[model samples]
Target: MTLLWIITALWAVSFSLIGVYISGQVDDTIAVTTRMFLALLIFLPFWRPAPWRKSLRMMATGAVEIGLTYLFLYQSYHYLSVPELLLFTIFTPLYVSLFSDLLARRWPRQFWAPALLAVAGAAVIRWTDLSGDYWIGFAFIQAANACFAFGQVWYRQQSMGNPLPHRARFAWFFLGAFIIAGSAMLLTADWSKLPATPVQQGVLLWLGVVTSGLGYLGWSYGSTKVSAQQLAVMNNMLIPAGILVNVLFWGGHIEQWPRLLLGCACLAAALWLCRKRTPAPSRST
Candidate 1:
């Protein structure tokens, strides 16, 4: 399980590079479509869906929850630095916690203490040397997180007992992603100006196969094996992990050690909360 986390962190970093690599070749729509198409190719052979039997609700859910959200996020790479774009992701757990509270009809008393701590830590990160685009990118990142947080909750609620296995779920998601992202590409991307260099093509291929297909597969597999709260905690680490990787390989720079320390402290607190045992529901005496 720990190994899974390490693997995911490494992939998380690598995926950022893939995003930068493709920024020049394809528009967000095509890159997303290419990713989905590759993932679908890997999944479709494994899980065959009856052409007409796939439900409209399932299709729409996949499109909104996964496809469109990813489209916006991949586009963020073009407009924002890796570190700046990742900071926006700090809002995911906050939004998820809020949504969970609303849907459960009960606030998460356990989360509030650590949540505040996490926000304070993120604020520390912000105090470091700021870029002009950071503020603007923050807005887009928040929008992306809103979509992801809402979609994740809705998908989990609606699909908890869904008969489709993980592979099948991936298939459906990719199918819908292909439809939605393909349409967006047709409208937004200039097909004539596609990249011709081997390095560019290699990057796109890796993005599609490794990051889009295998990364999602690994994440879904790990999700099934872990609790949701644990997953949330692990997600927070993505920011630090992403930044560290970019700094080492892609010339990513951080101005202050305080930001790093604060972020790590916040992640530690979240993970601690996630690891706490929950009491079982009791019947009325």
Candidate 2:
């Protein structure tokens, strides 16, 4: 849980960085592809061969979770403001809880309350007018949200039999992401819009190495440590954290004081409720 909190903060910054530095300046496909490729490279030195079946599953998970999710997310930025994007992702906690229960074949009803509470909290934070293209952007974000939630739950439940350590096997995950994102880049990338400035290159490197590489690794590992219910609620923590980052550093036009405090209170209440409901014993993976 501590690891998750740390990664959540890191990811909050990433949301703003992508919006401010990368989204408009770089082609979405190219950015996604480069990020995944660089992340893959970081783990390549530790890679070891695994069973073909397990490798395939990890790859597919990465493809949908990181690769396809990023595709929709970056595209949505074309129409939505950064705060709108963050607000739209409030639905993700519900998706995460639903998918986790469905995959586990056991409905944990306790999760729904916290998940919904988190949604309400996030909704309170972004209570404002919508853009003309709001629905279109909303649809894209929902697709990304569902994919990401499903992937995390699926990966958490997977069983690896005496396989290499997660770090050693993690390269397969990014390899899968690279395959999808790389293909998309080939199909749609604008050669003309490639990173032209030192800042762009630096941002790309930071995103690839620190954000994508370490962030995903830490997040994936952390997911294994908590209950699905806890994971569901924790997903919303990003909303407030990201909003704070946007407001502070990205010049986001949010009413800064009372609303933010109320939202944080709601999120904290949700997390507290989740902690009270003890999670089931960890499943063998």
Candidate 3:
């Protein structure tokens, strides 16, 4: 927990920064690859080799989660409005729940309720009219969501069995991401669009070193501390938190107060459900 909540607050500001400073100003591939590269370097000093199997697993998770997820996510902004992008991400909580349950091979009835409620809460705040190309954007976001959900769940489960501390083993994860990200950058990047201004350079540096490096570390470690239900619901918390950040500092506006209030209430209830103890699903199921 606490790590998760803190990371949420940190990430809430990241979207706005990318939207204002990086998008269209920099090539997505370059920006992403640079972040992954810098993030990998941050953890290099603490890097320890896990068992071959565990190392490969973390690498795969990083490729799918950070590499593919960011690629699809950045592509999505091209096809979708900011509101549309936010709306599409409302499905992430559901994906997190589904993947967690399926991977565990058990029906955790208690987890589903809060996850669905969290979805509802997030959708309430972010839902808006779609543009004509929504299908493509939606598909990209869903792919990102699936990758992200599976990665976190896989990491959480594996963390339980791993002997090494989280910090010591995270370098492999970032290295995996860098491999994929760097390849994508090589293939798709526009050299002309690299950071030109001091502001842009500064933004990239902050995003790469702090946002991607420390942020992912906090999230990975924190995911292992919470139940799947809580983790699922927390995925949605970023929506409202991000919106609030945008409105307060970035000249964004809320379209509807009622929707915001209702959504907040639903999110509160979902969080309460996560905190409350419920009967576990029988093993026979």
Q: How well does model 3 score by local distance difference test?
A: 0.78
Candidate 2 lDDT over residue span 1-285, tens digit each: 999999999999999999999998999998999899999999999988888988899899899889999999999998777876886676677667667656767565687788678767766765674445765786798899999998888888773353567787679899999999999999989988898888988999999999999998999889888877678767888987898899899899856668867876776677566556634424542
Root-mean-square deviation of each candidate, in angstroms?
A: 4.8, 3.8, 4.5
Looking at model 3, the pairs that clash are none
Worst 10 residues of 1 by lDDT: 276-285
By lDDT, the better pick of 1 and 3 is 3
Q: Best-fitting candidate, measured by lDDT?
A: 2
* CA deviation > 4 Å runs, candidate 1: 2-7, 48-54, 103-133, 256-285
Ranking of all candidate structures by their lDDT, best first: 2, 3, 1
lDDT (Cα, tens digit) per residue for candidate 1, span 21-82: 77756666766787778878988866756445454555665677568877778766766678
Relative to the true structure, how large is the alpha-carbon lDDT of every model?
0.65, 0.82, 0.78
Q: Which ten residues in a row have the lowest lDDT in candidate 3?
A: 276-285
Rank by TM-score (best first): 2, 3, 1
